[model samples]
Target: MAASIGSLLAEISGVEDPIEELQSLKTALLSIPVSALRDSVSGQRFDVIFSLLDSNEREQVELCVDILERILMALSPVNVVQNYRVELQGGLTHPKETVKILALMQIGRVVEHPDAVTEILNNHDILRGVIHCIGEEMSVAKQAVQSLSKLSHSKPGLDKLFQSDLLNAIKDVMATSDIIRYRIYELLVEISSVSPISLGYCANSSLISQLLSELTGDDILIRATAIEMVTALAHSPHGRQHLSQQGIMDKLSNMIRGAETDPLSSLYLPGLVKFFGNLAIMESPQQVCETYPAFLDKVFEMALDPDPAMIGVALDTLGLLGSTVEGKQILQKTGKKFKAVLLRMSKHGSLGATNLRVRSLDAISQLLTLLPEQQTEDLLALTESWFQLLSNEPMDMIRNIITQPFPELHCSALRIFTAIADQPWGQKLMMSTPGFMEFILDRSTGQTKEAKDGKFQLVGTLAGSSTAAEILGSQHYLRMKTYLREGPYHVTAVATVSTEGAD
Candidate 1:
């Protein structure tokens, strides 16, 4: 932006090939010595270059950001960010997304240095500019969040962003759109994930508490929208403790309980169920269920709903609740009603919506699946009884599911079988089920690659289980082990002895 480059940038409007002219100017600008420009530069020269960056006359945005970055990089050698502080912050509010992105990135560079982080934070214009970028493009908003996060590392920087007038400015922008509000929450959660002190910073911002309040607020839509951020905050140990301490867990539980009678519950019930389900998995499934009986009741209620969207959410939550040893044990406590739900979904063609059916079987399989480390005698018996309750003959029922042409169902069913393949009772069912063992040995079936992998994994689990050798018999056990060693796609090479007089 000094006189030499400033004049070319200024005259570019008169040229027919402005892009080419800008590119050539950028190249020459890069060749000039940084010390020379820093000596001759003033704030007004920066204004000249920034005007070109903000120009609506030419649409060459990449050229503008590139030229600005080159000049900044030259100034960067001596940490002269304050020289063009006004223009760089002003760049954030420019209508173009590229300019906003460059401004956020340059601010990020300052935040990295502890000594200089406050230089950007102490300036009210730069703070406002950063908050203003949240409504811009996703790429730009993401950088803005990153820059804010970098500033949050130290005490003074954290105090300024969280407790100052800029916090109010952020809330005002958050009111602009759904996307922008979520981005602000993302920024808060990102900071909150750092430590309790960082979350305390978020708490001071009021936006964090505001978001949690909306999760139970009278507006059903706000409650639904706020659940996602709550789930995000729950990802950290401190956040979960924070949420639990604030009574949000109980408030959501009460909200869902009342939603059963609310006609508007359909709008938000799925998100609420998803949140508790994730909470159940993240913390203690048994503890969450014991603490909030209504939550699980709503999950099972949603499970059998006529609507696919609600039921899909229900099934996913059930799967998460069944993923751990404790989760599986608690789900087994639900007993007959849940098993009936699984049976209806297992009967393929009627519930032909592929995702719903896939999710159902996946949930059921996970509920019954027992890992070796987790397989106590009590759990083994629990899994075996649930399998039997699924149908008159669980083997035939699963075999039918396996016969379905859908590759996803096929893989999911095989996973179910893999889950039970190790149980002593499960092994006995396979022995007497006629071709069930043959099914394990047969290699000629035409199946998708995923199905083939599923079959191989089934054999692998069977071969690896402790009592398989005794229960499956030595010959069959050795063959399954061989199949495991051979890998999923292994093809047996048949030997052909050459005849003496063939030619």
Candidate 2:
């Protein structure tokens, strides 16, 4: 089977119609065993496989590199880390662009291997070869630089890749080729995932200035990718300030409001919403209100939108923003409108509708906590309505709302239920639901947010059977007891635990 697979790969690797053969070779390569590749002790056969590569012509070299990519991909994870380090150091100057390309890809494939990247970092020669290749045309340059960026950011003991000369290489490539600059955006995304700290490198190295300048470029991809990288950078304090300076949300909002044929609008909008929300949470709410009033209005428009997803983003943004004082007031003024929409949505809407309702509940919950204590009835009425819906709603929607944004809305809903039990009608409403006891038990003991005894003592206390159990559980149930020890503590305690689940 090994010999037949090798011969087939060889035949396809060197065929006249390289593209078609390359595709077939890629499919066949997946079936080949990595163990067989490592045990290729016949030097003659290995040489024959290597020589089949057409290294002289650009097109052929790319095709051959694609095949080698499949081979390396198959061998990855099983091949020893030291073998890759040795191959990469030796392949850097192997006199063929195709071979160097394959080496760069192999380096990336094995990047997660135990000590492979550490070896590359210690051996500066291989790193320099990768930097030199960054000047190649756009596609190859993108692949090489992205691998280098990932190594520099996430791979431990590879800080040496960020040395002065390599940094200069990234800048030079971005300066010349828009394609390479676009790749910078891709590389930054990978960098952010592995090590969010590396966004600072992109911001400080003048890449951010160039990227923001390119936002107005004719290339829609360049603009969209730039916005994405900028968002990742916004994860840091310095990056957030940089985003503000570039007026990123204004640019993104323009893109959102404008008509772009680009397919990335969906991708762009979610991140943009998240960035604005992060800014609203991190910076002063008054500052956000002062700075981007139109932005705030646009977000509110999204919350009341017909699309469930759009409404969800809008609600999440509002929730994040409502965590601030001025933002809370803004949400309060808009709450009744959003709540009406949510109540309408909950009637016959899909699972997403229920999820959006929970988000609305969370934002309203936050706003209520910030409201004046003497005037909390309006919010209390809305809370009562939401709890009633949760008790009688579909099982899936109830589970989704509880599990979706753990702890935040879950804790808020529990608080609202406890508040409702104080009223005679509220106590009667909760007791009418046959599933109420089972739902509470599921939430308290089934590894959901309420299971954390530290964060959710109230739920446990309300579920504990008798006075002695309540007293015993109450010792460690600080948050729960605090809710109990409040006004009408004794009157609400029995109603809180009333269960009609089973005999």
Candidate 3:
């Protein structure tokens, strides 16, 4: 059967085969096992299939299309892709667009097989067809890109894929159409996520410039996708440099301004903010500080908006921005105006001096930390008035500070409290804060153990403690027991630090 098919291919190449011969060859190609199709003797047989698949003759082309469909449905079995190179090119350029599309689709479906991927890389014209389909129509183009993702899967192969100029083709598709751009952006992200080094190739291409242009696009989804891709690019040291060179800061700042209240804008804001925050290199900390006040204004505006979650996010970012050195320098330049706004905000009841107020308070705390010691004095004085508010705040509120999105704040605040407890003057300020000590005591309770001798083996990791055995020493246990019975707060919440948690 294979020999007959080979004969038919040679005969058909003459353009003089009887129609019946073409028909029989098509049936045989359809019946041949994909594994057998990879056999040495099957080369000529595949050539025949490719010939008919590429034929300009109407019936021959249709038959070839159906056979290609069958082979693809068979999972392009056995990777019989090598010897069919010329034939594959023929299908890629078939006169009918639908046939050309199907050929590319078939190639994509099987392209996961190493040999088939190699075949794709080897035939530049066929690879071009795949990219063309990606640029031609949204659905078809997306499908074409989906195939490119497979070629970029394995580590070495991703490097090879880039070497083949396929990565550049993907970048070209992104440059051409929104749908193509969307698919290509996501695929590049997946590839980069797997092998960050591949991003260098993407960076060298026009990917950053094109994506930056899309930042200003009217389509929110397009803009969001572009930002996501930018986030991936900014994740790597190499990619971040490319982004800086692309003038991403100015463009992103503009996005923050225009989209502040658009409702759809914040969808991309956190990630964009995080990415900008994470970039290892920036044009200048001063330049960033110059632009950041505009961002802070938007953030403060969002905080005052009706949305509670948005308010929290805004407060959090304000806190993040304020914690930075440049942000502090910027805050310093603003001087008394900044201090005044903070004082006024502290007195404002909308933040309510409640747990819901923690986000705001935490932001204030970060701002205070960012200030110089002398500069923080005024804020510390303001805190004396809100001291009762903190004193009355729920254990859950304190627990949340230690437990929530930024556990570092909770830890920092607690450590400060611990330090204050150790000072004569500071201890007076915190003397009435019974729950705070009990909170630390609860966290330390896990260290206690019952010895085989029926006594306690106390284990502890207290800061500045000389030894674990010294913790809850006989005298201390009595003190702890008395404190537990008459404790200001009877219950405490212990937090586990996971990556999703404190860590």
Report the lDDT tens digits of candidate 1 across residue range 1-503: 45666667667757655787787777777777766655434443445456666566555667878777766755552264566677777778788777888888888888777667757767888888888888788999899999888888877878888778888888899999877888898899989988999999889777788788777678777778888788889889999999989998888888888886899999988887877888888889999988999888887777777888888888888878877888777776788766766665555312568787788788777877777887788988878877777777778877787887788878887888888887777888888889888887787652678888889988888888898998989989988978877877878789999999899
lDDT of each: 0.79, 0.55, 0.54
| Model 2 lDDT per residue over 1-503, tens place | 55655666577647665556555555665565655654332221333334545356566556556655655555544352354455565555666766776777777656556555566656666767776667675555766766776676563523454445666666665576666566766665455444335655555566557767766667656665666666666666656655667777677666656534656555556656666677677777767655666556667666666777777777677667755556655654565664554454343232444455556665544433333232255555644554455435533444445555555445545544443433333434444656553454332333443434322343533433233233323343454344445422122333456569856
Off by over 4 Å in 1: 1-59, 63-87, 113-118, 175-179, 345-350, 441-449, 491-503
Per-residue lDDT of model 3, residues 235-324, tens digit only: 655566656677886778777777756878767766555555444123334565555545555555555566655566666665666655
Predicted model with the maximum TM-score: 1
TM per candidate comes to 0.81, 0.50, 0.47
Candidate 2 Cα errors over 4 Å, as ranges = 1-86, 90-125, 128-180, 188-204, 219-221, 245-270, 284-290, 307-309, 319-329, 344-429, 432-435, 438-503
Cα lDDT of candidate 1 equals 0.79
| Model 3 spans > 4 angstroms off | 1-180, 189-200, 257-275, 279-287, 322-436, 439-503
Give the worst 10-residue stretch by lDDT in candidate 1.
39-48
TM-score, prediction 3? 0.47
Which residue pairs show collisions in model 1? none
Better of 1 and 3 by lDDT: 1
lDDT of 2 at 1: 51
Model 3 per-residue lDDT at 345:
40
The deviation in Å at residue 422 for candidate 3 is: 9.3
After TM-score superposition, the amount by which residue 479's alpha carbon in candidate 1 deviates from its true location, in angstroms, is 3.3
Evaluated at residue 74, the lDDT of candidate 2 is 52
- Model 2 lDDT-worst window of ten: 39-48
